[model samples]
Target: MRVTTFAAFRHRNYRLFFVGQLISMMGTWMQQTAIGWLIYQLTGSKLLLGTVQAIGGLPTFFLSTVGGAVADRFPKRAVLVLTQSVMMLAAFALGVLVSTGQIRVWQVAALTAMRGAVMAFDMPVRQAFVVDMVGRDDLMDAVGLNSSLVSGARIVGPAVAGLVMGRFGTAPCFYANAASFLAVIGGLVAMRLTPSPRMVSPESVLRHAVGGFVEVRRNPRVLGLMAILLTVGIFGWSYSVLLPVFARDVLGIAEQRYGLLLAANGVGALLGSLVIASLGDYPHWERLVTGGVFLFGVCLVLFSWTTRFHLALLFLALAGLGMISFHSTANTVIQTSVPDAVRGRVMGVWAMVFVGTHPLGSLLAGILAEHFGASLTVSMSASICVLVAVGVSLARKKGNGALRPNVTGSAGTAGQES
Candidate 1:
């Protein structure tokens, strides 16, 4: 059977969720671009930029485990509603502060931290909820499409934010982001989902959290994937913290051109996501995951050294493509390998390593950039990622089978209703 990229769209709930998320995420990207630009404008300090990002991510690092447990114990949709509502309020508050010209660096940090805390609960639950919407059969397609949605927004949001900020300022971006939440909330309200059985453990939330860690430890495949994700998350993804620096200092570009650079990256990511979606039931996930990481690392290293605007954009686009390819495949592999009962908890652990470590990466990048300059710091970080990818590939060659896909055995049951 031919695999269609839109296979997941057959499910109504998934369609609603997808449409809502695409719209909302565009606003999210806008806000994210604005925040980074605003901070860079306000402080002009690389260290402060990284510091603020670190503060924002710290809450997810600490609390995502408990958030995962909450997801397993409650209805995922309801949890998302609450979390989304809080996030909307926080965005609006930031917009108000910015519009009134009373926005300080501390205020930005505080609001960012608030949103991060909400996302600790939001992200894992939202990830696990994909199965609830479309079940397991089209999970990979759904995952790929969802990634494309994010990347698609990434493409448009930064470009539009640049125009908006250049004309009206950053406040409008925040306000726009706050308003975007309504689409998602409405979609959640409109969905008619059959609630799956909850894994309501009699144990404490801490115990449930511990069980998640135990699950990762017991599954060597998951453990290996998590290790790679951690390495990439820390060194590879954190390079984004330096983009504003690269744009202003190295590329000598204004906001409009900077936005184009971001959009270039997004376009690459979107193409990568489409490739994944079109693969249907292809089984060579290990190849995609490892190759994608290697490509991303190489492109990032090249991008870090390039001062020419066009060359930098080309490298960043390739890096973005590699990034989403690895991310989407890894997520599919992990989700399929785990049981539904513990999916949320496992994803929570995933969030802890993947999202949580971002703060450390950002902070480290900032400190390094402040002393060594952004170009050298980014190159050094990307080089680490390259080394790690090569190591993983060599290890896989040794027939350890840790990174290989095992989708047909017990794992195949992951998509079935609980």
Candidate 2:
């Protein structure tokens, strides 16, 4: 069972948190799909859609470190509760405005910024808490499982989101997202991890936050890892953002078919996650990140060129595999390398790069698509990814390339502890 990753379920806190988060993630994906459609409908400009998404994503890069500091120094449960509440309120407001026919492009941008601010705080704390629930030994399994759920929700949620948006309206999508936050809050309250001594009396917030940055820079391995992961974020993982374009332009599909396009990628990601979880340990970090990310870039480029929808779908799955491989491995490395004191802050930076940097790719792709074409823009993005991967790979050194997998029994340890 321990080898199976079901071992993490023996812990009461993780069990509840995982189940609740699974529901909330599904709703969040549903809302995300709806937002893109709603914004596209209202503005009728690809640039504006790009702008709206850029607004939502930009704040995470700025505020995540502060959020991480709070996570490391305070009770993660309290931090999560506060952030989730803020998110719920923002969702409710969006629903109300859209429902009343008063919503504008600016309003969507503003509200999305609000939610993004909340998420900046939420991501690090949530990631940091994984160790608390399962310990370092199980971190890989937990991370894999966590990643799996996100992919699972992506697979199922979009299909449901498209249907709801098509049948009902966008308001319900917003409301559902707001309601999902409660599930996360409930799980946080049920957790049972003890805070460290350093975590208490956290007065020097600035100093503590800076510490994480200093530490990451000081560690050659981690700095290299960040560089590798940055490529993955900026290029490899833009599939979800590009999905709407693929559905409308390349495949010439409607709502359900659009949903299936995402479904194929999600299914692939889910399978990737399950593979990582069953590995029972982290693989060679450098090789996995670089190779996986390289494959993603290659697949995206290949998929962009294909006219056949079925063939594109196959390539998308390959892209998903590479994307998840990059994600799962990078996560394992970062969590393992950092000390507990600054773990949250380090993971915050990870979230910033892995997710926050995506807006740049999205915005660039949108602009290029508007000027040239969607296919060319996607191809350009893939080209950049290839360059990044090759450049980073050549510069990378050994030992830092593929550290041994650490699978100690304790969940409290970082994956690097092996």
Residue 387 accuracy (lDDT) in model 2: 82
Most TM-score-accurate candidate: 1
Worst 10 residues of 1 by lDDT: 409-418
**Best prediction by lDDT:** 1
Clash pairs for candidate 2: 134-411, 135-411, 135-412, 136-411, 136-412, 136-413, 137-410, 336-416
In the range 259-306, model 2's lDDT, one tens digit per residue, is: 666667778888888887777643445666777778888888888878
C-alpha RMSD in Å of predicted model 1 compared with the true structure: 1.9
Q: Rate the local accuracy (lDDT) of all candidates.
A: 0.88, 0.76
Off by over 4 Å in 1: 1-4, 409-418
Model 1, 121-208: lDDT tens digits are 9998899888777767778889999999999999999999888988899999999999999999999889887645666568998888
